[model samples]
Target: MARVTVEDCVLKVPNRFDLVLLAAQRAREISSGGALTVDRDNDKNPVVSLREIAEETVGVEILRESVVQSLQKHVEVDEPEEDDFDNLSLDVVGELSAMVVADTDEDLLTIQDEPDSGPIETEE
Candidate 1:
């Protein structure tokens, strides 16, 4: 896991064709890794090997299309809504971002408090 930093929250990604393809490949790698190593200070630097990435299950096209689709859908620039202000809180957005990329039900559940282990006992 990487330390959080302001630049991570705001950086312009190159949307050029070759760069987009490269990024999609990288995304696929991260998505399929046993775990990812991140270094925020190093430009949210990700250290993933192409060989390790190739071992991942995702087809390259699927990875590319998913990335392209998400970019196309949200290309418009807009003012942040009031609810967004709330939703964008460091805790909420950060947690939600984690949820978006979680690969396992167990990983997602780990973020939450344990639900009543088996309902609560009532006091008389």
Candidate 2:
């Protein structure tokens, strides 16, 4: 109990940085009313989290995943199924491919959004 918990935790979680993250995440969970796997022993939340990690009472992989989930700003959602894909194919092939009809009997008319103007000099 007197020994440094970080040293014991390093044996279970090799990376010191990841160990810190996992320990911090676990400590936050404890602060948020998560059940403790080990005795409080008058220790703080961080120390209790380290003790749990060192004793292998909590799964390190689960802690790692939870930390990742907590840090993610955007969670990916499952894509919709392909049930409506047939309708999309039909629309693209038939409806979308039709040409616009004009008042005159021209095959295709040029639709200009803006009038043509001479090039102007810039004050570079």
Candidate 3:
């Protein structure tokens, strides 16, 4: 389980997967159905209210800490170079190669700029 500690709030998340799932779900719910209100006078911003969710869920705190620790561990390791892609799957390798070949600027015109394609624009 991971732990997220923010101020006096201590959340103990049961597992790594649950941490991401719960955070995402809570965030989505809050984003779609308005943010949760915390009755604390000290909390002013909407983001602060969101933090209350973590404070309420002890398990989530633990999971958050674990995620942070895992991220830190990865940060300490030296990143691999492009040459490390030798063993990658063919499909993934092909996709990676496509990044250099793809033309992202393909004729994507805005609606305002588009010629009146709906009906003829005759003189008034």
Best by TM-score: 2
Per TM-score, what order, best first? 2, 3, 1
Model 3: per-residue Cα lDDT over 85-123, one tens digit each: 664666687897786455433334343467865887679
Off by over 4 Å in 2: 1-3, 81-124
Q: Encode model 1's per-residue lDDT on 52-80: one tens digit a residue.
A: 22334334455566667655855677866
Return the top candidate by lDDT. Answer: 2
> Residue 54 deviation, candidate 2, in Å?
0.4
Residue pairs with backbone overlap in model 2: none
Worst 10 residues of 1 by lDDT: 44-53
Per-prediction count of colliding residue pairs? 0, 0, 15
RMSD (CA, angstroms), candidate 2: 13.4
How would you encode candidate 2's per-residue C-alpha lDDT over 22-82 as one tens digit per residue?
9999999999999999999899999999999999999999998999899999988786757
Taken over the whole model, the C-alpha lDDT of each candidate is 0.49, 0.86, 0.50
Report the number of backbone clashes for model 1.
0
Quote each prediction's TM-score.
0.25, 0.63, 0.28
User: Model 2 misses residue 97 by how many Å?
Assistant: 20
Compare candidates 1 and 2 on TM-score and give the better one: 2
